[model samples]
Target: MDFYLTALLQGLCFSGIALGIYISMKIFNIPDITTDGSYTLGGVVTAILLTRHLPGYVVLPAVLIAGGLSGAITGIIHTKLKINPLLAGILVMTALYSVNLTLMGRSNLPLIGTSSVFTFVQLVNNPNQNTFLILGLIVMAITLLIGYLLKTDFGIAMRATGNSESMVRSLGVNIDRMKIIGLALANALTAVSGYLITQFQGFTDINMGIGVVIIGLGSVIIAEVLIGWLNITSVWISLALVLAGAVIFQLVLAFTLNIGVDANLLKLATAVFVLLIVSLPRLLQVKD
Candidate 1:
């Protein structure tokens, strides 16, 4: 029970990355592979800064900005250089590998003696208080802010660009600007997730982002499945579903582990779970 609770909390905390993936894949119709690199970039930047005695609040925004800039570069390359979106994301993600290495000043950074947002949360000294509670609050705040932003005029333009680039351009919306902003916002959320994860896990590794994009996609797919593929009428509900899906996914993982599954096989399990969920609707339609 304790183990399941811990996994649930961790899943909820990491759901921000899933929401970011939702925006790129579902909303913008973009396969953003840059999330893999940006996740590590956020962890590296946050860990390095925290180790250097920087405050968590300040480092948090810096990590977000760094991730946003990385995404913006990918958008620019795709929009201006006429590179394919997938290829552009690949290039940016590849570049971020080295950038993350430089940010950490090595292949990995240890947070053994460092202070993080989690540490501050623990300072309350309440036995019942935990990092998950603090992270949940942070995620909720971000979700609300993003929901509000998506209702604004610029947000509508961005959404229109995703729905039909040509139509949005005909309507005098700057498609390039919309794409850049969307990508930046997506990666920024991803970075923040990475930062929080690093603090929760107590270490940062360059290779930690391996298969992260797949996990994000899996989470989004699972969320959509749980919500019955409903058109996201309310932004809050959409975001909430993302988080709920992540928690459910983690619970599945926990169940596998409890059943004597090899830890090394977890990725395979995740892949299979994602595939099953993604294909469920199609299978159901055929059955009907």
Candidate 2:
């Protein structure tokens, strides 16, 4: 039970990344790789501020700004510099490695006795349960906020810019600006996941964000599959499913571990599982 509970907490922690991926990949159709860097940047910033005895509220904005700037740089490179989106993201992500390392001054930074966002609020005696409640509320609030954003005019423009860039551009909407803001929003959300996960796990590592994009991709793909199957048209339902997919993905991983899959082989297993999820629909369609 505890194992599964931990997975659930992780899922909630990663909900932000899943949503960020959904926005960048599904809405923008740009496979922004900045997620890996921004994620660690968030953790690095959070750990630094938390160790100084800063409040969670103060750390939150700092994480957002740092992550947003990283993503915006990628966007600028792609839009103004005429670089491929993938390569722009790669450049920013690469540079972030040194930035994160320099900021941390080490490969690993422990938060053993430090206060964190989770510690700031004491809702219950049991730490794990308190974490669950806090995480759940945070996830819920973020989802609602994003859902509302998508319903606004600005959100519609963001979606339109992705769906029909040329058309939106013809309407005098600066598509480049849209892309920049969109990536900024996406990476900011990804950083939030980093912030939450670091606090929950009580540490931050320079390598923590490595290959993190796969988790976001897996969650988004799972949500996409369900959206297609149900022919869902509602934005709120789709967003909710994306969050659900994050939890479901984590739970599946936990179950795999529980079933005695070798821990060392977990990454391989994750790749294979994601591949299966990605291909199953196409294979079924071909059969049909």
Candidate 3:
């Protein structure tokens, strides 16, 4: 039971990234691989700020801004420079590797003695429940903000731009601007996940973002499946399911571990899980 609880916390930690991917991929129809780099960027920036004894409030905004900036760059390259979105993400992601390494001045940094938001939570509550509460609140607050934003006029424009770029452009809407803003918003959310995960886990590694995009993709895919199956139409409910999907993804991984799957094969298993989720719907539709 305790082991499953830990996995639940882990899923909450990655919920922000899942939301980010949902915005960029599902809403904007763009494969922004920059998520991989931005996730680590958030962690590295947060670790350094915390190591310098900065307050959590300050540390969080810094991580968010840094993450947003990376996303904006990818957006500019794709929208302004006419580069393919995939290639632009690859370019920024490649550059961010060096940027993250430079910020950390090492391959990894441990927050052995540093104070984080989690530390405050730990001080105020049971150590065992600290992660559950802190991560849960953080993700919930962000989810509300995003859910509200997605229903606004501008937000509707962003969604329409994704669904019909030519029509959005014909309507006097700036399609490029929408894409840029959408991508920036997406990466900013992804960075939040990185920031919290670093603090929650007590360390930040340069390679922490490795395969992170896959995790986010898998979570979104899982939620999408559930959303479709349940005929959920409310944007708020849809977003919440995405967050729940992240938890479900982690729980599945934990279950596999409990069954004694080799640790190194976990990534392979994740890929297979995502593939199955993505394919099953189409197969079912065909059968119907």
Candidate 4:
């Protein structure tokens, strides 16, 4: 029960990255691999600030800014330099490796005895319950905010830019600017996950963000499956499903671990699981 509860908390913590991937891949149609680096950038910034005795609230904006900047660089490369989106993300992600290392000045940083967002307010005596409450509220708030934004005119243009870039460009919507902002927003959200996870786990490592994109992608794919099955069209419903996907994804992993799967083979298992999720639909279509 405790193991599943922990996985539930982790799923909530991961909501940010899941939403980020939804925006980047579903809304913008970009396979932004910058997720890996920007995520660590968030953790690095959060760790550095918290170790200096900075409050978690104060550290939040710094993480968002750092993540946004990294994403903006990738957007600029893709839009201004006319580079392929995948290549642009790769270039920025590669550069962020050095940037994260330089910012941390070390490979690993522990956050023991430091105040975190989860510790910011003690509504309940039980730590796990407190964390669950806080995370639930935060995830809901973010989902509502993003849902409202997607219904706005600016967001409509952004979505249109993704669906029909040439059409939006013909309407003088400045697709390049939209792409830049969209990617920045996506990465900023991804960074928030870094901020949450680093504090939750009590440490931040240089390699913490490695293969992180797969988790986000897997979560988003799960959401997509639900969306198709339910024929969901409302933005609110869609975003909520994404959050559910994140939780469900984590729970699945926890279940796998509980079943005595080797911890060392977890990544391989994750890859296979995600591959099955991604390929199953196509396989079904072929069968039909």
Estimated TM-score for each candidate = 0.95, 0.98, 0.97, 0.98
True-structure lDDT of candidate 1: 0.85
Candidate 1: misplaced stretches above 4 Å? 122-128, 229-232
Each prediction's Cα lDDT score?
0.85, 0.94, 0.92, 0.92
- The numbered model that scores best in TM-score is 2
lDDT per residue, candidate 1, 1-288, as tens digits?
877877787687668789889888887899999999998988998888988888867898898899899889988998899999899999999999988887777888889888778667564565225666687788889888888888888777777778899998998888888888889989998988788888878899999988888768878988787677686677678778888888888889899888899999999998888889999999999999
Candidate 4, 1-288: lDDT as tens digits: 999999999999899999999999999999999999999999999999999999766899899999999889999999999999999999999999999999888998999778888888898999999999988887888888888889999999989988999899899899989999999999999999999999899888999888999989999999998898789998888998899989999999999999999999999889999999899888988999
Model 2's alpha-carbon lDDT is 0.94
Which parts of model 3 are misplaced by more than 4 Å? 122-124
Higher-TM-score candidate among 2 and 4? Answer: 2
Whichever of 1 and 2 has more lDDT, that candidate is 2
Per-residue CA lDDT of candidate 3, range 147-232, in tens? 88999999899989889999999999998889999999999999999998898889999999988999899999999999999999
TM-score of 4: 0.98
| Top-scoring candidate (lDDT) | 2
lDDT: worst 10-residue window of model 3: 119-128
Q: Write the per-residue lDDT of candidate 2 for residues 1-288, one digit (tens) a residue.
A: 999999999999999899999999999999999999999999999999988888777999999999999989999999999999999999999999999999999998888778876778999989999999999999999999999999999999999999999899998999999999999999999999999999999999999999999999999999999999999999999999999999999999999999999999999989998999999899999999
- Give the local distance difference test score of model 4: 0.92
Q: 153, model 2: CA deviation in Å?
A: 0.7
Candidate no. 2 TM-score: 0.98
Model 1 lDDT at residue 185: 89
